[model samples]
Target: MIKTWHLGDSRQSMVLASFDGRLPEVVYWGPALPDGESHQAIATASAADVSGGMVDRNAAVSLNPEASQTFPGHCGLSVRDKNGTPLAPAFRFQTETASEHCLTLVFADNALDLTLTFNLALEAKSSLFKLQSSLESADEIIVEWLAAPVLPVPAHADEMIEFSGRWCAEFLTRRVPFAPGARVRDNRTGRTDHAHFPGLIVCSQGTGNTSGEAYAFHYSWSGGHKMVAEELQDGRRHVQFGHASGSLPVGRTFRTAPLYATYSENGLNGAATRFQKHARNLVADGARSPRPVHYNCWEAVYFDHKLDELRSIASQAADLGAERFVLDDGWFGRRDDDTTSLGDWVIDLRKYPDGLTPLIEHVKSLGMEFGIWFEPEMINEDSDLYRSHPEWVLGPADQIRGRHQLVLDMSRQDVRSYLYEHIASVLKHHDVGYIKWDHNRVLPVVDASQTEGTYALIDRLRSDFPQVEIESCASGGGRIDFGILERTQRVWLSDSNDALERQRIQHDAALFLPACVTGSHVGPRKCHTSGRVLDIKLRSWTAAQRHMGFEMDPRELTEQEAATLRMVTGWWKANRDWMMQADILRLDSSDPAIIAEQQLAADGSRFVAFAAQMRPSDQVLPHPLRLTDLDPNAIYKITLINQDEAPALSRGAPLLKEHDLEVSGQYLMSHGLTLPWRFPETIWVLEGRRL
Candidate 1:
């Protein structure tokens, strides 16, 4: 059985676990504030009048998952404290388990300001209290920053904090290093657990505070609690506030996955305990090799199917030295397009004709791993599950509405059990080596009877499927949190797969998650997602900078382009292990408009710099780029290769040209890679042993 320790309480401050844990086990959720940093401690709740009748007695509410649930707002005089903190849409805060976890919220009338403040908080958290404006290691703990990204990652492990389009969190684990697919064992629990958040976001909405308790006034998407009024013996009338997030609460579902939110801090603690959990997540070796850059046929293939067709593609892929072939969407039950039969897991005969067995065999015959995609968290309005149980939607029966598709109530045990069974069954059926688990819609509501409080649904999934290589997606980047990462290995960086756009996305993505996270670039002219025609090698090399892949038809590329991709594919396959773990050093773009750079460092050595000298101009602009975290005077050899056909140049691209570039504290070189006519670029190398 999964074990948990009981916590102890104390006086004053109501013991936000003042004396919890006989010792300790996991990262404690206290507050998300960074140490030595400060924010307006919410204008101080102690001074507010907090006086009134248990206000609205005739109020009604409900927790149904399908209805249009709304936290009714009232127009009343704004209450101001002695310090004059204006209270509009105030809420009372009191949790049955307040000592266990605290919620920190960022509310700005302006959405952009909310994002800006969030970014500031992220910067503060990254230093983990250090007063500098750079990235590195620190220990003010944070399992998942609420305001960060939905799919969060542990990048530097201690200090750096990452956010992907403000939906996912990424942890920087380099300082301590850990294996990618391993579990983190806690001193508290002899049992180890996986730690990485990746998944779809089911729900998120606004709330208001009406009560005056320190937590008395607050708001969230919750029902079942009634707004009540009462008269005390003092002959004064008072009101009771009802809401979600405390006794009132905020409900979230992570595709029925395990999402542990273990810490929070207001920045005043001697040390944030969540950092300890991060420390625990640290492993003996770094995460690398667990993720591979294989081709996934989803946008590339969609619904149109024929095993022979894919087999033909696979033959070329295998010949190109591709490691795996992922068959995405339309393979399961009658699903042939954006709108069609969903929630049915059986393979369609009209398409595959003969079940997936032959296709699996065909892929296997070509000596490549096989994978599949599934939108398990959602069901179409015309889906089998929806038709069978319309009541499964999350809001009140009469008022319920979905973002588009109906999401399964993973919050329910039966639903959890069923989905779990179906997923595992599919995996075993094909002995599938990989799964690109996709959840296209955000959750509208969760009404599972067996679950309670916070993180109920996610916790349950972690308990159920302990082994699965799931990849999280939400339309594009909606739900990405640390909780999902505990189970899935990677996440789609963003749905914007344009090569040029990917540079920023990749840079921004790596800021928070590990370098192994995948970002695909497949399309014609630009990309289907972006509409820019890019050099395949530029796309491939940029992707090499990440867990890259192509999302285009094999037939579109010229034999030359195909050959070019095959060559990079060769390099990627050979350096898969090295690429995944090397500390990345994103360089200034060779082409100010192009996303380009290099990566280096392994086994405690000086880092190597890889730059994509992409210039829109005709000549190579010889600008010396600052190589990140490098040691000065470390004898290193720089290698450069031509982008076009380099058969003769392949013996080793660098010629005996006198290029003793001088660098200051770190070696800086002015020697530039000659940009070729065909245009994909290759530059940099380690002089000797692994850094």
Candidate 2:
């Protein structure tokens, strides 16, 4: 009559129930329930009473809501028969398979020969719930819309936070209040685009970074994704995420990407830490420890690749403590600029005259590993690859181009094969250790198959060359998501290296990304993307906040600027072993002008808090910066690492400016730290250790 399943970790539990052999619905999901709790009672308690305007019985908003069931809100599944006629088949539970951490439920519409399956699992270490759904038919059917297993939003949540951004500025959070109707975001860009990053955070009435209840959701998909957060007339709410509608073509079987969700009782940081841990420990592979000081020559030598000049830059980068040197773009085929030579993965003899060997060897001689860039998913009309295989491009010939390029139909095996051979050739012959994989343009059409094909190629290459690490850079942060991170080891967070912009971008992005996998490079004094000239101190400290690196030409640095950068790089290296594993917690700053974060070590022994004064404070006096996630009983010795950077105008004697002070965690978190004043575009670094 009634069947139920429960999946839980130490932190959270999820209970699902099938009423009268119909499709199942999530009856409970939140804090971990006691072992003796009855799931049957929970399912019964989740039922709603009938009203005058409602149907005789409340229609179940099950894992996959059906249109035939008379549901009020958005249906989870939309389908059509072979002849383009709509099919509204109500699924009934047929069978189920269960495990301690995973559960699979299969429901079938016997009359229509349609079978629907829901698979749910709890990641053991991360405590994140993963859910997905699939459809199968005895006859071919066209799937219009199919969501991953739907989950109910807590009634107490008042607002939701979704990520939105553009080139040079990524991971901007937007807060949307829940209204009566659905808040939908349909990204037809055909990539895990910058405009709509496939992640959401629903917070209770009053939630902040350090405290209050929050629920995080991310669709681990790289294709065009569709998100729907809706409220029903009955006050119930649900959220759905899957590939964009029509992304899947007519087929006998279809499936949704894994929807990763986690409940956070300890505010956004709890969810953030889980996602970060999952990304670092499970998803990403071959990430070098100590996260080598990255040096990318993109901003320095965009398309002008000269062997002797690159050797000089590499030598200077190595002197500045760069452990990895990446030759970004313009290394291949007649590639003079963005207008030509995409999809051609070959070393330009005109640039090197010999090959990449001399430059790579020169870089290695300076004690840095060699890395190269490749835009494997794009093609230029002026290139040899496009001329030879014009039919290999995705979408129509008349489709608008992005950055003078077209999408290479990753869905084609031949295309993937061609890319693999050329990309693999370089890896085979040379001692190349890393690849800066770039996707410069959006797809002409929203097709899920394109993402799948890209994954296959990456998987194949990863299988063949497990030692070589890859960094996913879609024109800088365009294609960043859990799906891409699973195959690649790192991500170029954004193209804009302006420290002021990065201060906010990195703070907001901390909701899902961790430092080790997030690449932050110090740009030129005048940022190439934003053209904002910032001091070397702000630039160096900002870069040190994450996986530290430098992208600017070392030759441009003044003697003092170079010395300051060297000092910061050395400091980063000194603490990187522990800092790389630290939890980046966003501090709730009293001053809106200040964006700060505390990187607490995994073992809770030490921390470094960075407070960047973005603008002049609204008030004359600065507010005390309170830290989070510290033991109230412990006494810590705190010191301002950059006390000397205080401006001449900052005549006030803040306790931190003079000397290190020992204070209890309660005092620090409550009354907070008092530091010397800093001008706009400057940051204060506070280091603390439990005494």
Model 1: weakest 10-residue lDDT segment is 185-194
Query: Highest lDDT, which number?
Result: 2
Scored by TM-score, the top model is 2
TM-score of each: 0.58, 0.99
Once fitted onto the true fold, the runs of candidate 1 whose alpha carbons sit more than 4 angstroms away are 1-290, 396-404, 445-467, 519-526, 588-596, 604-608, 612-620, 643-665, 669-691
- Cα RMSD, each candidate: 15.5, 1.1
Per-residue C-alpha lDDT of model 1 across residues 1-691, encoded as one tens digit per residue:
1112222122101111101111111112123334432222321211123246533331211111001112232211112222444323212111122123232222222211111011111112212210001101121211111112111112222221211132222221221222232122111100011112221111111110111111111111111112222222322222222221112112221111112222121121112122222221321122224455577776557789877788888777677666678888888777767676667777888887778888889888877777788776567777777788776554455544444466565446666666667766776666577667676543344232312321343344434543435566655444343434444566676666666666655554443345565545444445776566777766776666667666677767788888878887777667767656564544444455334444554553534344443444344433444443345555454433332333343344334122332233244433333322223333333222222
lDDT of 1: 0.41
lDDT of 2 by residue, 1-691 (tens): 7798999977999999998988999999899999899999998888889989889988887898878889888999989899999988988988889888989999999999999999999999889999999999999989989999999988898899988999988998988998899999999999998888999999976788888889899999988999999999888889999899779988899999999999989989989999888887843467787689999998898899989899999999999999999999898998999999898888889897889899988999999989999889999999999899999999999999889999999889899999999999999999999999999888899999999999999999999999899999997889888899999999888988999989988998889888998899999999888888999999999999999999999999999999999999999999999888888999999899999999999999999999999999998888999999999999999999999988899998887888999999999888999878779889999999998
Residue 442 error, candidate 2, Å: 0.8
